[model samples]
Target: MFKFQLNAITAVKALVWTAVRRMEVKDVPTPTPQPGWVLMRVRYVGVCGSDVGGFLGKNELRRPPLIMGHEFTGVVEEVGPGVSKDLIGRLFAVNPIIGCGHCRYCRSGLKNLCLMRKIIGIDYPGAYAEYVAVPADNLYPVSDPVRGALAEPLATSMRAVRLSGAGLGDSVLVIGAGPVGALAVKLLSIGGVKDVTVIDINRNRLEWAGRWGASSTLSVTGDEALKSLRETHPEGFDAVIDAVGSEDTRGLAINAVRRGGRVIFVGLHDNEVTIPGNLIVRSEIEIKGSFSYTDEDFLKAVRVLESGLLDPREGWVDIRPLERGQETFEELAGTETKYVKVMFNPGG
Candidate 1:
C-alpha cells in the first residue's frame, strides 16, 4: 500500500516576533491511527481568535513550528483496535481537550479544568492538515458538515452563559460582539434571557449581534460609551459577560453589572487585568472566570447544533481553502471585516 502524503499549514518560528512570516504550507506524511485513536480526513477547520493569538505569539501555551487548529470536523478514515470499525466514514467534530480521566477536575465533571489536560494543536498535531489522529473518545458525529465544526466554539460560549447565572427574563449585557460573544448573546436569548444588550467597538459587529438575537446594540468606541451606558441603563444589567478580556472591557463589565449581580469573563485575549478591589468588595459582585468547555457542555453543544435553532448564517463565517490559511489569519487579525469567523476547507 502506498503511504499518503498531505499538505499542512504550519506556524514556523521566526527571529522577528511582529512579522507574519511564521506560517507556511508544507508537505508531510499523513498521520495514522494509534492504539485507541482514530484517523480523520479533515473537512472543515475553523480559525479561532486563539489561533490568531497563537499566530501572533500572544498565547504562550502554543509555541511555533506547530500545526494550529482545533475547532474542526472531518470523516473517520481509520479506527484503532478496541474501537468499532462501524464508525468509518462518519463525519465527526473533535473535542480537542485530552483530559486525564482520573484527575480530580475530570472526575468532578469539570474536565476543562483537568490538571493534566493536553489540548490538540497546542499539545498535539491538529487539523490544519489533510489528516489528523485523535483519540476515538473525543470525536462526536456531526450532521451538518458545513457548520458542524462550530461545536467547539459554541461549546465555549455555552459554558460562559451557563456560568453567568442569567436566567429567564434577565437583562444581560455582553461586552464584545466577536464570534464567542455573538454566540453568547444568541445562546442567552435561547436560554430565555430576552433582554440582551451587546457592546462592541465595531458597528458592523454590533449590527451582527443585533441580528444574532441581541435585543439592542451599543457602539462603544471610546470613553463616551460608558457615559451612554450609564444614562441608558442607570441601574446596570442583571448579568454581564466580558468577552473582550481587556482592561477596558473588564472594567465595563464591572461598571455595567447591577449590584450583587454576576459577571462571567470568557475572553482569553489578555492574561492579566487590574480591577477596582473596593468596587468589587463594596458591591458584593459575583465574578466567575470561564475557560474551555466541560464534557457536558460539549455534548450539549452537539445537540444544540443538531437542533438548527441557533443558525449562524449570513456573513458570520467566511470559508477559504486550506492553502490560504496564512492570508486569512492576517486578514482576521488586521482590520475589522464582516466575516466574524473563518473556516478552512482542507479538501477544497
Candidate 2:
C-alpha cells in the first residue's frame, strides 16, 4: 500500500471558478465519498479547450461557481462503503461522464449519449482540487499520471477518428491542428492512413501537427486556404475532420470532402453553423457529429497510453501548478498564446 498523509487532512486547496474569466485558489472542505464512490488524491488535471470556453464565458453548459475540469488522473486515497480497499494507492484515469445506469444508452455502454448524463467537472465537483470523489466504476487503472491525464482527450479523438471511417491508405484532412486535431492525425497515422493533412491559422500548431504524424501541414486560414486546398486536391479528400467547429471550418469541411466521403465534426467551438445542404445532398457526403467517447473507447485510450503509442510529455503540453490556474486560463484564452495543452498539478 502507498503511504499517504491524506488521512489527517480535513480541508483541501481548490481552484474555483467564481465568475467569467476568473478562477481563484481557495480552501474547500474535502469531499466524503458516498457509497460505491472513492476519494482520489488528484495528481494531474488537464485544462481542456472546453474549459477555456468556460473561462471565456462562451460555453453555455458551464456556469460560474463551478469546478471546471474534466480530464484528470489521480490515486485512490479512500474508498467509501461497499468499495474494495484494494483500490487504495492505485493510480487511475477518470471517465468523467456519469449516466443513469438504467438508461438505454448506458445499458449499451454508450453513456456519452445518455440524456441524463452528468459529467464530473461540469455537473459535480471536479479535480481542480487536491482531492475529488468519483464513482468507483469510473476509475481505470493507469501507471503514469501524465499519460493517464491524456486518456480523456485521446478517447475523444479516438471516437472522432473511428466515426470518420478512415482506414489504410486513406487521405484525411484535419482542421484546427489543436490538441484533438493533432491527436486525430496521430491516430490516423497509426491506423495506416497514407496522407494526413492538418490545417491551422497558427503556424506553431501546424508545425507540432507535422511532428505528431500529419503527412503535411498547412499554415493558412479562411477562404484562401479553402481555395488552395481545392486547387491542390481537386478530387477532394477521402475524409475531412472539422476540429474547429466554427462557421468557416464547417463550410470548408463540407466543400473539401470528396463525394460520398465522410466528414466528422469534433470541435465545440461554435454551436451553430450554416453549411450547404444542397451540396451535401448532391455529393452524398456523410456528415456526423462526434461527442465524448463511450466506455469502450475510454478503456482503449487507457490501453493505448499504457502501450506508449502516445507521449504525454510532447512539446505541445505545458505543465503548471494549480495556483497558476488564473494566468494559465488567461494565456490560453488569448489568441497569441503558444500553449496547446496545459495540465495542472493540484498537489504541487
Candidate 3:
C-alpha cells in the first residue's frame, strides 16, 4: 500500500501566460498528483527559444492563458496511488513527453515522434508553477537542480548530432551560437569532432561557443556571412546543422555543406521556408529534421550532466525570480542580449 501526504497545500505562485507577449505571476491552486503521477516542487525552469516564439505569438501551437515551460527540474513532493514513496524528496529531471502506450512510435521507444504524445508545457499544465504533476515513469533522478534543468535542451542537441551522423574528425558547421547550437558544438567536440565552426550574428554567443568547444567562431550575418563561409571552407563541411531555422540559415546550411553531406534542421524559428530543391537533389545532400529527443537521448543527457562534462551556468545562463517573467520575455523578444539562457526560480 502507498501513503499520501495528509496536509496537502493548496495555492502556489506561478507565471501564467495570459496572452501574446504577456506573462504575469499569479497565485494558482497547487496541483494534486493523479494515479501514476507525482507532484514536483519546481526548482528551476528554463525559458526555451520556443517559449520566446510563443511569447511573440510566432508559434501557432501555443495557446494563451497557459503555463509555458518544459525544460525544468524539481523534487518529487508527493506521489499518487501505486507510485513509490521513495521518490519523495528526490530531485528529478522530467522527460516532459508522454505518449500513448499502444502507438508504434511509442512502442519503438520514440515517444517524441508519437502522434498522440502530449507535451507537458503545451498540452497540459507545465512547471512554470511552484508545483506540477508529472508521470512517475518520466522522472530521472538528478543531483543538481539547475544543471538538471538543462537535460532537456542537451537531449535536443544530442539527437541532432546523432541524426547528422557526425563522427570522429568530421568537419561540421553549426549555424546559430545560441544555447542549442553551442551545446551541439560541445557534444561534437566530446565526440571527437575536432574541426567545428559556429556562426552567429551575436558576438557574445559566438565567443561563448568558442569556449564551449567550437574550433572556430564567426560573428557575421546575411550575405556577408555566406560569403565568409564559402571563403573559409571552399571544400564545404561534412555536416551542417542549422540551429537557427530561419530561411537564411536554412539556405546557408545547404550551400555550405559538401555534395552528399548531411544537413540537420533542429531549429523551429520558421515553419515554412523556401529552399533550392534542385541544389539539394543535384548535390545529393541528405537533409533531415530533428525534433524532440527520445527517452534514450534524455537519459544520455542526464548522464552527461552527472559526469560534469559541461557547465551550463558559467557566464551564459541567467536565473531570475518568476516575477521577472514579463520583463525577461520582453527583453529576449526585443533585442538580442548577451544572456543565452534564462531560467526562472518559482520559489523566489
Clash-forming residue pairs, model 2 = none
Where does the lowest 10-residue lDDT sum fall in candidate 2? 1-10
**Residues 1-348, candidate 3, lDDT per residue (tens digit)?**
122232469678889999998899988777778899999999999998888888888887789988989999999989989999999999999999999988999999999999988989888888888888899999999999999999999999999999999998789999988778989998998889999999987887888888878988887777787788788788789999999888888998999999999999998888888999999999999999999899999999999999998776677889999999999999877547787788999887
**TM agreement with the true structure for every prediction:** 0.91, 0.95, 0.95
Residues 198-244 of candidate 1: C-alpha lDDT, one tens digit per residue? 88867777787887789988875446777777787888888999887
Model 2, 182-214: lDDT tens digits are 889889988889688889877777777888788
Relative to the true structure, candidate 3 reaches a TM of 0.95
The models' CA-based lDDT, in order, is 0.80, 0.88, 0.88
Clashes of each: 0, 0, 0
* Top-down TM-score ranking: 3, 2, 1
Clashing pairs in 3: none
Q: Global lDDT for candidate 2?
A: 0.88
Worst 10 residues of 3 by lDDT: 1-10
